[model samples]
Target: MAERLHDPWLVAVWPGMGTVAMGAGYYLMAKLGMHLWEELPARDLFEVDHVDVKDGLIQTAPLPRSRLFLWKDPNEKHDLIVFIGEAQPPAKSAQICHQLIDLVRPLGVTRVFTFAAMATGLRPGEHGRVFGAAIDRGTLDRFRDLDLTVLEGGQINGLNGVLLGVAAESGMQGGCLLGEMPQLFSQLPYPKASLAVLEFFATLAGIKIDLTELESHAQDVEDKLETFLSRIEQAIHQVEGAGESAIPALDADEEDEKKKPKLSAEDRQHLEQLFTEAKADRARAYFLKQELDRLKVFRDFEDRFLDLFKK
Candidate 1:
């Protein structure tokens, strides 16, 4: 059963782990009870991810779950709690967040902050990035020291996104700490992404965590990934030199192939036009929403001023 979360001063976190041991050590410390507080759950995050449930396949969706860790300071008043994970939900990404609100609201939490990484397409020889956003002005102000930039066109499409929405709906303050990572590293869990996420988390949590172990683990993973890439490149080079495969043609248009008993030029043009229109329409709709939001804010201010002087 889902825990009835009370109103907690909850901290939501979702760091990539297990795929490689990069950020695993930070999680490990929390596991070893070496920190200021002990994890309330008898189980760890990974176990929670792999726990089995087979009830005739009525429904079996993995993830969209969170790990709850709680610690109480004997002399302090409120419990310090952290929630970690991505919830399973649609682009509206909300289901798991509802569960978190249940757990924290009952516990007296009124704030929810999530952690994530912003990925980027980087050259193999270039550096990475770290960025963030917040749902509350105060939360945004607090993390300003992390050198966080304003996310102007920000929208959440993942679990972290949903949690932020939960915070918004519940009138709770929320924020996200993100690390910019390479797109090439997107295929699997990237250690660089893990490092960026944890370091950023440490800054906000005010929790002193020694990342030395995590760093060592990240180095090992990085070496392995680099080796894998080198092998793949070498294999591709060998295949190309053998001449079994021809280079992809950039000029093979429908007009050239139409008379050869294939698709007509008109059909190909129609398909391309359909795809182009779909992409343009999606982009236009997104911009329209932004414009509407900006206009609404201005209108709200104007309405307030009009009422201010009214008898």
Candidate 2:
């Protein structure tokens, strides 16, 4: 049975560059104290491409899930529904989006929003600008009123953008908010971007949620990434100062391997401890992700790292 909602608006999210969309979605769900509403059946849309191996044993991994959570407004202005997809379908994303809208539309949802990350040349120390694209004139005007940079062109890859297109086709009003992230650190989790997107959304939606924790986390990550970038800059300067013959000539593969930092045993232990802390408090997961990225081992722990927000 569907719980009766009050003029609900839908916000859908999926994992993407810098974990921006997923991070914001999870934070919203946590802060709003939203409860799981329903899980969209998507077995036919997603496939298990691989199994997990732990302690030398192969374990069957479950298919990705798409879930919706509901939060009722205390002031009765409007309700909120957050849809978190564990992973985007490899194909037919538009079809699944149609199914999602069909489920929520009956509950009085008329507006949909999606969050994503936009890779730019901006440095980590710089604030991530919120970019927006709306499906209609009124929504675009709303975005302009919020002082967001309107996305004039270019594509928003994956379901974050595709879902909004489907919503527009359904005659619903919606838009996408894309937070700017450093292109060089696209593989890393940038909480600053997540914070920017949420800040804009909260204001636009006339909702109040404490952003102090996310603000602090964003600053922490920005400082770390800035420092890391400085080190790389220094290394580059030193290399450039040296004459061509002063540096050894190496193949592209070897150069890439040489540039990567080797993680020490102590670093691994620290990462394990951080992961444990993150498991206990999901807010700390970004910190764990930062450490993994610094050590260039995020890919190795990506699945388990993302699992921290599965609930």
Scored by CA lDDT, what does every candidate get?
0.49, 0.83
Q: How accurate is candidate 2 locally (lDDT)?
A: 0.83
C-alpha positional error of residue 269 in candidate 1 after TM-score superposition, expressed in Å: 63
What candidate 1 gets wrong by more than 4 Å, as runs, is 1-9, 13-66, 73-79, 84-95, 123-126, 230-311
TM-score against truth, every candidate: 0.55, 0.79
Tens-digit lDDT track of model 2 for 1-311: 44577789999999899989988987787667576778877676787789998899999877887888778999888799999888898898888888999988888889999999999999988777999999889999999988999999988788888888889988999899999999988987788999999999999999997787788878987887787788767666778776555544432322343377668889989998998997777656656755675576766676676565554
Q: Kindly report which residue pairs in candidate 2 clash with one another.
A: none
Q: In model 1, how large is the Cα lDDT of residue 69?
A: 52
Q: Candidate 2: where is the Cα deviation over 4 Å?
A: 241-311
What TM-score would candidate 1 get against the native? 0.55
